[model samples]
Target: LGGGMTNAVLALAVISWPKYARLARSQALTVRQQPYIEAARLSGCSDTEIIFRHLLPSVLSPLLVMSALDLGTMLMELAGLSFLGLGAQPPAAEWGSMMSSSRSMLQTAPWVILAPGAAIFVTVSLFNLLGDSLRDQLDPKFNPK
Candidate 1:
């Protein structure tokens, strides 16, 4: 069903689609200019074959890194939307809603506010760290010990 968090999900996807496409297209353009791709074309390889066999593999790493980063951003955005009453409905246990619902109790009970806030903080931090690690791993100059 296209209810609940679905609208936020769709909205974010639509909003971010252009950025993803531009990144992929730039990567593809760079990859295409590599000598190997030119050689593949000279060898009578079809466009589809060149794309699937060569370009996709080359572009996938950066896309994955971007996706990992975006995952965290998307989580935060969903939570923000939920807080604004545009995402998850009442009585649902979404972190943003939890924070929203707990706002009035902020002074009386600090733990209520702390819980969802901490969850969002930890999750976003972990994802950003994971993305950074992935980027470092993908870099040829990066050495892991």
Candidate 2:
């Protein structure tokens, strides 16, 4: 069921979308209970305005941060599927598949395996750090200083 980038992307999106949905739902629910929302309602803000102006902003920040964090995980998952021959067929170059195909060379030419592995490591680490930085910057409660 895999040979192209689109297939991998669709698979990952299908698998990961529920997490974001749940997060949005929870954030909305939490924000709904805040005193400011109550005050907005008391001051005659319509439901649509309350949602657009207040709830959306409150919920979107966490979602963006979560999406940033999920990028690395999704990439790893895509690579894993490719390595297992379930994603990104031979024509498509994927780090996991590259490493998988080079497994036999581990003893004779370890660099072949090491190169892709190192790339995956660095890429994943950078994504994770990006997510953390986003969280720190976006979330009001987090103060890195």
Q: Give the poorly placed runs of model 1, Cα more than 4 Å off.
A: 1-3, 141-145
> Relative to the unseen true structure, what is the C-alpha lDDT of residue 63 in candidate 1, on a scale of 0 to 100?
85
- Cα TM-score per model: 0.90, 0.92
Report the Cα lDDT for candidate 2. 0.89
| Model 2 ranges with Cα > 4 A deviation | 2-4
Q: Candidate 2's error at 61, in angstroms?
A: 0.8
Question: Which tens-of-lDDT digit does each residue in 24-95 have in candidate 2?
Answer: 999999999999999999999999999999999999999999988888988889888888877777777899
Top candidate on TM-score is: 2
Q: What is the C-alpha RMSD of each candidate to the true structure, in Å?
A: 2.4, 1.5
How many collisions per candidate? Answer: 0, 0
